[model samples]
Target chain A: MSSHSTRRGVASVMTSSTYRPASAAEARFLAEYDASAYATPLVTVDPVIVTLRDEQLAVLLVKREEHPFLGSWGLPGGFIDIRNDADPEACAVRKLKEKAAFVSPYLEQVKTVGGRERDPRGWSLTVLFFALIAEDDVPPIDKRLAKWFPLSALPDAMAFDHRALIDCAIRRIRAKAEYTALPAHLLPQRFTLSKMQRVFELVLQRRLTAGAFRRRIEPLVEPIADCFETASHRPAQVYRLRPDSGSLIFEQPLKGARRK
Target chain B: MSSHSTRRGVASVMTSSTYRPASAAEARFLAEYDASAYATPLVTVDPVIVTLRDEQLAVLLVKREEHPFLGSWGLPGGFIDIRNDADPEACAVRKLKEKAAFVSPYLEQVKTVGGRERDPRGWSLTVLFFALIAEDDVPPIDKRLAKWFPLSALPDAMAFDHRALIDCAIRRIRAKAEYTALPAHLLPQRFTLSKMQRVFELVLQRRLTAGAFRRRIEPLVEPIADCFETASHRPAQVYRLRPDSGSLIFEQPLKGARRK
Candidate 1:
């Protein structure tokens, strides 16, 4: 069982990854390759678009109109144009462009979901992406029955294992929240520490000790002069992500439990 | 556009990810679906099998025998037998079973690499996996020009975009090495701390301060009291991963630089 017997060939190679005609033989092989001869899988890129909605984490979903999972909710995603998409990232960018008007500072790949039984349309694979966008940036996507479901209240009638994909995305974002300033992206420009703590708690689904949370977040944020009036306590100082602090990695994971 | 228009539908959904006939129309659509009508892309799973050789990190590659790559080196992987492979992980495991004789405890999906132009045959995508196996555990397969190349010096003639894939795998391994006992899998069970330090350095491509390295690793490993004789220094105690510790994640990354 050699490696050659294992694959439907992709391309020729030379001094690098860029495709170059290695020889006349390889060129002939590409010309003669019958992609239709074999059973190829349907591939797609689905983004789990995340945002803060009414003090809770929500993901955007659209109701399908056609066959297979008609009326079932799905993440906003689709196939590569082939004529337009240069690569997966380009396809991801294009998918974002199609969904809403705003751009997110964080759009990262989570993982690939694939299997034979996962999709009824034959073997299928989907690359899952985690995108964090502001809630106000997205206008209603024309009358396609789009809605935001809170993380704790996802719909039961989900399409094509997309529920699992959203779960995977939440786990990834939570992991990032443990050691980086990822949750800050979900907040406004100048927010109170109390609001920031609530956002972290919302994403992580746990409460953090106020003292430890402040200590860990102090280096990542800088206080502003303007204060946000608090309901009960005195006016709290506002803070923003430090200038040039891109995805700041903290020294430790935030242990949400309070210390003795 | 709606999500239904974005994809070639996978399947019908219900109260869960499992496929079920949500409506009579959905069942009818599945029965009449024609997979051969469209130009679907080729999807494959490639594992970056990694280990240590001669005090340097190495990856196993096989020279291709077929047309697209011909004689160029490739990561030992192939297409999924949709009939047999229940999921992508199973496909990766089957590829490992075909290559050599070893089972790695750590087999993880890194990311998905996809594009239309990447593979000259047609639109192609591969799910990249990171597999860590001990070098000694692998015996030679039926001789087909299989060889191990150190990470620093890979073949210039690589098949597809495998060179980029290899680089991505290395970056992942190095990131884990900073805060985990991942590189320990590259070492023998009852190895010395000195050997562990070397393995980390090999994977990270940087020198580490011995004291700081030991301080970070102490909680992860338990001394067995068996000593490994050194050439110059007194015999060092052998250590293994803590019994209850599955994958030890340290509080901070190992700063490789020495202190004043």
Candidate 2:
């Protein structure tokens, strides 16, 4: 046995060093193993950047210039720099800015993908991140290699497990939209009721009756009381999301009569 | 530079192995890097086994017998065996069964914990699984030195960021219970409405009005006529969950009800 036990709390292996020591019994038990015996795995981060463009839901993707499935588009992602940031979410934000010039978006941890053979290079675990941005505010695609793709028409031939990653992200977003204020993150700071409804419609892939949708969202939003004059027949009322409300609203059932 | 370039089209990655090949230019760009330079990462699966015992929600934990936080208690977890099961969820279930001697509870992927230094062993990533088992059905506590601790009174010392892991799992369960039928997993196959309600109350840490809770749950259960034999006072009706119904129920709000 190598006498190096990673197991914690066993009393025998404790030693006097900066590295906490394991108990002697634990050290002896783990000594038979060697971390070097297995292949060193790579850690990467994948971002699911979502935006509402022209009332339609979209995801940001990059065109691949490398092999495997060359010329395919996918979410922008890369390896994590361990020394840079203490938090994975922070690393995700930093990477998005560096790779795609996106900043300060509504970002949350999605999940991690770690199938041994999912990646051809070696065993790797990619931390998945979901970010929401207004469609219009997205900076011009910086990486000539990357482009914005509508959620409905994603290009084929994504890299690695990026396709599965995107699928999970989209499903989560749609499911969450039903319960939380996540979709609001995709809209502008100030928007009309109809505009907000359109974002939901596009994400849900179904048309919500205008009257029903408005009634459903009435309590969730407080009217900003500002009028955004439209070129159409009537002026639309503008509204902003209520402040300090966390993601709990989605848990409440949608209010209003179902549109027949 | 290794000639094996893995980066390819984004969407095409979703398709099984028989897709198109990368172009020569794309291959050349990706092939330049030495994929072997980096070491493969360590991926582990940690099971957050939760059960309701003595009318309290508890988590099954093992006392660390080695270094790190020797003597501290934490969730039962182990390294994932990729060769045994293609799915991570399966591996998680396996670990719980083999290590904890428990089977077939409510299991779901909670989240992945991957921060540098989270584990003193080395760079490690853990896929957390949460399972809810009926307290009485749980096998005798593993004599090898594991214990069940109530959610309200977690031990002061725990191994490898498990305190945070448990906290995250609790929040996830609480949020999930509000919208999904997760609490049903904690009860027997056939249970009374009061039993079901108690499970919810314990997990939520709040008392729910019996009438309100029953109204909310009525649609979810299949009423068994003449099946109730009340123990005291009024014999409450007993119901069993409809096997075919999905765990989630989308409740559109009622007309004229307060939205919030």
Candidate 3:
């Protein structure tokens, strides 16, 4: 049996006449297309907003007010506004602003999720984005539906494949943390090395030695001269991401037990 | 002015009556949705099929047979068969088979590109995938249009934003080559360390010292007793990816002019 015969055809509904290409060749090609050749799937941008809270990673989720998954919790997302936004990242940032009333300095497209059984309506494709924000800057929540839940104490059931999406995002963060300064996205502008080490431990869920971590991080960051005085302790030296740091690739921070 | 007012709404054309959810509560919810609430964009899966040829990176592109850039070269792709395929990867593999009659051993989802202007047929989203195959194993071309073009000498005109897509794939391959054992995908089942280093140089466009390259690759590969005699030299040791190597992350292979 041929795979082509077994596969169902996707119907197209795009009318080519509406598009006005810059070039005459492109315009001629568009004018000759079969507009209804294939069916388009619904695409959405879903952001997994995360931050460090109480020495643990936390994710922000909103409760669904309407049907489909009424009262069920899910990641804050919406259909991409194709007419207004230039790209998926813009659509995701807009969704973040609309749903969470927060702006993230660091947002990276992590993965794309699509399947026949993922949605109840029809075929839907969601581009998952990993967004990290500082804990202190989390905006005031006016909408009663949104809340930050610690990773350890997540809700029993999420609206869709959100639990899996969160898992993927965490994996990306931890994997990236090995070579890149990803935890900086979750910390404040200037922070102590001790504070940064805590962020790594929270994300990796493993305690790392101070000396080893300092050696790993020393080249990636530069001293700021300014000191941060913690309550009941002497001032600790603060550091910031180096000006020349460009996705600084290094050896894995924590390794299999080596010579001490 | 509210940003919401300026954003164009996505129309939902998914008929609720056709969907029959497993859960009674979910079934009730799906039946109640107004299908026309949002508009969905056309989603596609575009795979960049890459192989090493003549110590250079080559990409496989098929000439467009139908309208919407007819006769022009583009990455082999098709509208996702949402009803039949289980996921995007399956859709990509199917498209690859249909267009190039190629089956890749290593395939990974790279990125998702979406916007209003990406497709001349209206708003569309394309999930880009990176697929690598051995040069000798490439299937015989039954279609007259498909051809492998060196990355340095691409055609002047490519369908859609395929040029940008190719550039993105190259960037990802180079960035990933710094940490992971990704080049193994482009080589045969077993190979010499010298042959593997050449693949790296081709992808990264840089010359690496033998000692340094070997040191970086030591942990990721396992040596085989079998060896292949070269034209002018003795037999060289062969290696393959370690059984336990899972996206093996390592330190940057080359540093600034190390010990000349």
Candidate 4:
């Protein structure tokens, strides 16, 4: 290891950098520097867990038990536990497990909302993350603590800027669905092509021609030979996503049907 | 106005919600709720100011004057002054102005970086943003305080996870350039088609077919009739972005010329 490797500083995480040891003057400044000298912003992580509830695209929300908005519905999240959580994403994962009892869902950061007046406590910021759980994979939960609400019909009262947060998440999903196999995360590991198309339509809230969708989806999925034996007797063929389909990107969007 | 209209809480900023006033029991809880009871994580805002310097795409970096990584290069950003900045974007804009003398460049949040070990002080979080300044509109600056480095060859020594931050920002810009009119922001309000193409090539690091590029860009730009006074007698034409071109997205990616 190099001499500067022992000294922990900013360039530690990034590769391809030669860090130089601090000089004596810098060490004196560091001794005087206080981490808590300034008022730090209240940072939190919010995970908007999403799944299909009764064929409708819905997001999970928890009942607030705190003073800011007691009894109000809010996204499943709270302040990051600095003692255990290493990063915002780690905090989001822990929140998902603690508040909703969900585990290992496909989560992606969507946006960050920060300001002085967002939370009544003080200047605050929250990283917004959206998690997708297959409709059939949703575990049992107590309705009084948390419940799923369709994107179209949320409760009359919500806490913080959650309404905007959910709207942006849905917008991101819709945009990705046009050119990527993102909607596959909302279905069973093995599903019919028709079901995959339906999930895409549900998330995108539009009708797609089969020929067009198939042309776009063919490269992203593969037919299961075992399912083919049974599906051959049936109508719809069953398929699973290709290993790299999760990151697939098409050059063009799946064109929607013309207006009636 | 509703009876609860005066209540300032979580739902204050979001529109379309029936917010009920807190109950007497909740008010008691708020009285004892300490805003600073928990250790708040250190939060900051970073703006990666990008421009075309000497015919190459470059990002502005400042010389650190403080202890950690003292005298090292970093992005043009800093902590959000909670007393003044209303949101993270506002803080990013302020940092751009304070550090680089840049005012109101095209700013957009690209990502957020946070962890306990990223900073030596304590658990910290930072929102990452990238701003685009037109090559012709770049203001003069003091080299001692800040300097621009081409993306291909950055300084050997840097601060924090800035390399990853910059890579992510450039990836976002390249991905958007494929289908949207994002490259226009890298040039002056008015430019020739060739100059626009050059900017796109410099950003994407690839050559595009002239015929294909013009077809995709035509609807997003308008030829200047005034310039026709002399351009009518010339081979090339000058154009300006359309009013709504900033958000314009094509159905397909710009086609790059096939490799020989």
Each candidate structure's TM-score, on Cα atoms with residue i matched to residue i, is 0.86, 0.82, 0.87, 0.88
After superposition, the stretches of candidate 2 with alpha carbons farther than 4 Å from their true spots are A1-37, A248-251, A255-260, B1-36, B39-41, B83-85, B250-260
Model 3 lDDT per residue over A176-232, tens place: 877777877888878889888888778777777888788878888898875664753
Clashes of each: 0, 37, 11, 0
In model 3, which regions exceed 4 Å deviation?
A1-38, A226-233, A251-260, B1-29, B32-38, B251-260
Best by TM-score: 4
- Compare candidates 1 and 3 on lDDT and give the better one: 3
Interface C-alpha RMSD after superposing true interface residues, each candidate, one decimal: 8.7, 9.0, 9.9, 9.8
CA lDDT, candidate 2, residue A194:
85
Question: For residue B154, what is the lDDT in candidate 2?
Answer: 85
- Per-residue lDDT for B1-260 in model 3, tens only? 10111112322333323445646776776666433334456678899989888878999899877656778899988777655556788888887777777664567899998876678766678989987788877767656757999999999989989999999998998888877778878878788888888888777777778888888888888888766647546778888888887777665544322455
List ranges where model 1 is wrong by over 4 Å.
Answer: A1-19, A93-105, A136-143, A224-233, B1-19, B97-105, B141-143, B225-232
CA RMSD of all predictions = 6.8, 7.6, 7.2, 7.5
lDDT of 4 by residue, B106-223 (tens): 6888878887666555567889988778978888867767888999889786777777788889899988888777878888988888888989888878999988888889888999
Q: What is the iRMSD of the candidate numbered 4?
A: 9.8
Q: After superposition, how far is residue A83 of candidate 1 from its true place, in Å?
A: 3.2
Question: Candidate 4: what is its chain A TM-score?
Answer: 0.86
- Residue A252 in model 4: lDDT: 70
Q: Candidates 1 and 2: which is better by DockQ?
A: 1
